[model samples]
Target: MLRIGLVGIGFMGRVHMLSFTDKPMIPNAYVKNGKLVAVCDIDSKKLEQAKKEIPSLEIFSDYKEMLASGKVDAVIIATPHYLHPLMGIEALKNKIPVLIEKPVGVFTKNVFELNEVASQNPDVVFGLLFNQRTNPFFVKAKEIIDNDGIGKLKRMNWMITNWYRPQKYYDNGSWRGTWAGEGGGVLMNQAPHQIDLWQWLCGMPTKVRAYCKFGKNRNVEVETDVTAYVEYPDGGSGVFVTSTHDAPGTNRLELIGNNGKIVIENEILSYKKLLVPENKLNETATANLMDPKNAPQFEEVIYTKKELGDIPWGVEHAITIENWINTIEGKEELIAPGIEGVKALELINSMLLSTFLDKEIELPIDSNKYYEELMKKCEKSEFKDTWRV
Candidate 1:
């Protein structure tokens, strides 16, 4: 059985703990080689409190102690956004795998650097908690998109704003808002999932044009609203609008193809699929597209939509964790591995860069240069992550 430790005792750390318990629940706790062996935090009171709940576990004020103790096989990092890269890099350097919370780093350069570090330590498995990728709805969306639900993808409209955060939510921590601290607002923190989905389902656009407003409707340092137009090759395109200030919020994704359009709202995937020709003999390309002998055919493919509505937070954590566990046991593949997450990170970073620079930025962004640029305007920040209840 692989023993594991968790660092950070904030809201996300607790969520990580809860997700570990949700696995099977056969023994009402983590098992199958995965156990919460140790925990660490600077706050003695908080660490002590956590120890009581997790009896038989060890606690430490310094994360280095936990690593040096060598009592576990892996670590889960649920610390603040800025600390992700540092902690993650430290753990990998120690030869311990890590399952870090979202937005891997404050900037994409950090993510790429982290990836390089992980590559140096192939014995360790670095992962991101991109739990949403495991959700049935999204998994199905990817499958359909890969199979071509829409003919020659034409347009996409994504209107997602159900992630409204109150000022108190930001005010709870002095470091919440500020270009230097939390690293941009909604897009970096709350919207990584949507951003990941945008990239996952539609892939990164060759070019992006955007307009963003920082604290226009709220008192946060980073942008609260954004509208962007993304241009892709294959004559396909998309328009994206995201915010954390909309009232009676909504999460909707609309994809239009030459044949049909698909809408995913209310967590339900409703579609008007265009048909494709049946009985085509081509193996690789649609027989009609590849050969004149096989003219383009038209037949609609229906997806048996799963019953999904109002998904709970961290719903897919268990799936991600279980996959990691299985991978360690040589039973399956890693879920949301670190390298793939870098792609998601770049997409988000570019969106922010485009909005900030008022110009399009290409994919696989230069994180080091971007970080340098970010520092020029951001000078410094104040969010040290108090881990508000």
Candidate 2:
């Protein structure tokens, strides 16, 4: 079996465990194909708790020692957002495949460095836990776009409000609100899935203009609310909106394309393709590719929709775990490998920098410049209730 080691027993760390057990998000191979050999955390209490949950596990307080022991064939890093790249680098240095949790890192530079380490160690597989990639709804959406059903996407919009966080939640951990610790507020934590979706479905926008409110929802330093505008090279445009403050949450996606319109609400997807432009359809029953206003109606094709459950750490994390295992075995390509991590990291950093600059940030941002700036912010900042244990 593919032996695995997991580090960080916080919310995400537990999430990684649950993610592996539930096969919906991750492929069954990860569960049946591998084994969870060890669990690690810096907090002794947390380590003890993890043992209670998984009594048979080989528990450790030192991840470095765990790595050196070579008991596990791969590693999963679910530490805080900032620790991802650092832990990932260490994992790769040991020639071990690593599946790191999202945001990849607080800044682009860290992600790039981690990627460099990944490239050098091709023998070792590296993946980010962008599990939403494995969701059926999103998978269906990608298929539609690939088949050109949307037909040269003209515009798209997302209003995701179900993600709500309270002040107490941030207060629970001193590192929760700080830029140095968590990296960002909603953008990094609550909305990375949306970010990955927006950029993934429509392609990374050439331009990203965003406006955000800092400490808006609670007494923390980060954006709780954000609305971003994006522009694609082919004149395709999309809007990404998110908030951790709204109540009676509303989640929706609206897409308008040359051939049709698509909407996904409450996980029920629907779409209609107009065959004729209204300007011409008034005179004759004709379909227009340029402007299909009267296209034949088409209802959204329902893929065997799975009830959205408690969103796991993400969909691909476990599958990525398996990919790491297979990569080690020379069995297959990494499911959600390193380059994808870089892209996801780039999108997240661009949005944060957009808020800071009060301007639209360009794609393919200068990661090196941002890393230095982020480091400066981290060095001077103080953590409120940072974990001392």
Candidate 3:
């Protein structure tokens, strides 16, 4: 049986714990042979509270101590964004299978370092907590795109603002919205899923020009609102707008291509398949200005239970975790490997860099320059923290 220890007992950490222990009761909590053996956190009170809930649960204050103790066969790193790569590297170096929580790291350089270590330990199981990869709607979108369902993408737009965080939410934790602690705002924390899904379904854009508003709605040091314009290599363009202030916000993705257009929002996918490809129409039509003679056909896709709107959050997480455990046992492949995480991080870094330079930034951003700029913000941050333990 795989003995799993979870590092960090914060919000996400607790969610992981619930997925492990509350078996039949928890959504998507199905693994052949694994047990929740230990948990680690810096706060002793939190550890004590955890022990009270699970009397047999082993607790440690330091992750290093827990790793060296040999009580766990695998470790789940659910700590802060900055600590993800660092903690994951330590687990990999210890020859322990690791499943790290998302965004990989705050920056690409750190993730590269962790990836280097992961490369050397090729046999060790390394999975990322990109649970949204399990969503059915996204899965169908990827399948359609890969199969040329949209045929030569021309435009993409995603307006995701469901991330509504009030000032009290940020004030509740020391590391909530600071540059030093959580990295960026909506892009880093709330929108990583959408960003990852964006690239997963539509492919990464070559250039990004972003306008980010820091603390525009909340009293935080990082950006709470952002709108970015991206250009693709195939003459495709995209607009991504996200914020944490908009209540009754929208989560919509629209992808237009030569063959048709796809719209996904609020648990529904509306696909518009043109009878004649837009490119074909443009080439064959003789009229000075004209629409396609044959009207476009539209259909609402009925998602299987596995699709986006159907899967519960806890179930999706459990499904990803099960894939990780099965991968470690050589019974199955990982749903989301640790390496693919770099794409999202690259996008995040590029957006921030574009915002800082007030110009369009290209893909594969200058990691060193971004790191230098990020450190400058961290150095000048005026956020007061009386909540760290």
Best by TM-score: 3
Instruction: Please provide, for model 1 over 64-111, each residue's C-alpha lDDT reduced to its tens digit, 9 standing for 90 to 100.
Output: 788879897888888778788888889999988888888887787777
Q: What are the RMSDs of all candidates, in order?
A: 6.0, 4.5, 2.8
Higher-lDDT candidate among 1 and 3?
3
- What's the TM-score of every candidate structure? 0.86, 0.85, 0.92
Off by more than 4 A, model 2: 18-30, 276-332, 384-389
Query: What does candidate 2's lDDT look like per residue over 125-198, in tens digits?
Result: 78766777776677667777788777778998999988888788988877887776777788888888777777
Q: In lDDT terms, which candidate is top?
A: 3
Off by over 4 Å in 1: 21-33, 276-311, 380-389
Query: Looking at candidate 2, what is the lDDT of residue 269?
Result: 66
TM-score for candidate 1, residues paired by index:
0.86
- Per candidate, the number of residue pairs that clash is 12, 11, 3
TM-score: the better of candidates 1 and 3: 3
lDDT of each: 0.74, 0.74, 0.85
The sequence of per-residue lDDT tens digits that candidate 3 reaches over residues 1-389 is 88999999888788788676654446665544678899999989999988988788999999999999989999999988888888899999999999999888998988999999999999999999899989888887887888888889999999999899988999897788998878889999999988988888888889999999999979999999999999999899999999999998999999998887788887877776766666556443445345534344444454444444477766788888888998999999998899889899999999999988899998879998998888888776665442211
Best-to-worst ranking by TM-score: 3, 1, 2
C-alpha positional error of residue 59 in candidate 2 after TM-score superposition, expressed in Å: 2.6
Error of 3 at 290 (Å): 8.8
For model 1, what is the C-alpha lDDT against the true structure? 0.74
